[model samples]
Target: MGVSVFSLKGKLALITGGGTGIGLGIAKTMIEAGAKVVITGRRETVLQEAVDTLGKNAHYRVNDITEKETLPAMVEDIENSIGPIDILVNNAGTHHKATAQETSDKDFERILQTNVMSVFALTRECARYMLQRKKGSVIMIGSMAGLFGIDKIVAYGTSKTALTGLVNALVTEYSKSNVRVNAIAPGWITSNMFLNAIANDPQRKQQITNRIAMDHFGQTEDIGHAAVFLSSEAAKYITGVVLPVDGGATVNF
Candidate 1:
């Protein structure tokens, strides 16, 4: 028997916005797959709770990603204190649900600041080390809104769409250095808040369901599994791809 290609044993992963939801899902799954994970968020309490839930292999850091000036030092500190960051998951983002006409320039710029600029800044910081060592994997958390048009989320869609281009451009530069970059476009992942929102709105639920070819929303672990694959040895040759983890939602009529 040989080593499992999918095994993340000895890997250290850094995930942003990991206090809850899909980020936490990815962290849990990665830990189960044998990686030590550090989760970052703006709230200390939330991060602490998430780490407690994640158990011994998990850690937490409270930092605002929008503070771009701190990212380089933050990355260095993490690497020195924990270990070299073998994987980076750009999972932190802000969503704006408003028509383009209703979304002000400030609203749009805020979305970009969190979703695009910060992501690139952090990725650049981590990639510098990865490129030097010639080993690393970077995963961007994208959305269905980025892949296609959706009403009332122009700003979010733009940010995510930017990630696609970022992944492409970064892969071109980093693949040669053995550092892989990719994006995961998740569609309608179920959460308590989302479930609650739809529970009282059957028509909206049905409309959403009808748009999905699978007629259902996805689970957070669905995204975690995809992240695991993309970060594992199994995907060594894969790069510059935005893999959709949607339940056929992106392709439905």
Candidate 2:
């Protein structure tokens, strides 16, 4: 009956891509749960807007995740300026909508650099501090493309699938230091991008709806709630798991 286990009070969370969509959703939920949240994105204007909307518990830092070499300094700056990051959400990523044959080598590498390499680089830097303190949580934003498969997303899918392996491997090492590593594989969550596309193509919308057993697309807050649980003491023993925040779409037959 005690809900304190789910509380994120006094915690500090650093979320990448927090200017919009699911990232902003996570920041909102974390702030409501009593955590001080710092969101990062490449767009200062967008980050500023999100922070302003999120009120006092929210902050923003403009940093492109693809800038791998600068991640260390960015982490240090955040630590000194804000506080030790108790939760880190690797949410910034790029998507390439193309078949394997159509996806150029350059395109694939670009996706990997943004989605995989940068995530690893930032994770390593944050893990250094967490390991030293012997406490922290790392959450990677995955996708249904990685969990199953979808057309026109070869490069993006590969990058997300790699996170599963990354989380598993990191857990073996970081768990010893109490630094948990995990990932959240989100389903077709409703967003302006998705809604606009679906509105124009009813057939495509129906196809997606039929796949979801819940008969509806997920909300951004669904993933946000899951992230909160994973970051909170409620999920202290949970790590190395790729939690599906889908509405059973991944299991549909």
Compare the candidates by TM-score and give the number of the best one: 2
The weakest ten consecutive residues by lDDT in model 2 span: 192-201
What's the count of clashing pairs in each model shown? Answer: 0, 0
Listed per candidate, the RMSD to the true structure in angstroms reads 1.6, 1.4
Model 1: residue 247 alpha-carbon error in angstroms: 0.8
- Taking the tens digit of each residue's C-alpha lDDT, what string does model 1 give over 1-253? 2458999999999999999889999999999999999999999999999999999999988889999999999999999999999999999988777789999999999999999999999999999999999999999999888899877779999999999999999988998899999999998898654575477769878878898888568998999999999999999999999998888887878
Cα TM-score per model:
0.96, 0.96
Compared with the true structure, all predictions reach lDDT values of 0.92, 0.91
* Clashing pairs in model 2, backbone N/Cα/C closer than 3 A: none
Q: Write the per-residue lDDT of candidate 2 for residues 1-253, one digit (tens) a residue.
A: 3899999999999999998999999999999898999999998999999999999989888899898888899899999999999999999888776678999999999999999999999999999899999999999999988898777789999999999999999999999999999899999898764575466668877888888889778988898999999999999999899999889989996
Question: Which candidate leads in lDDT?
Answer: 1
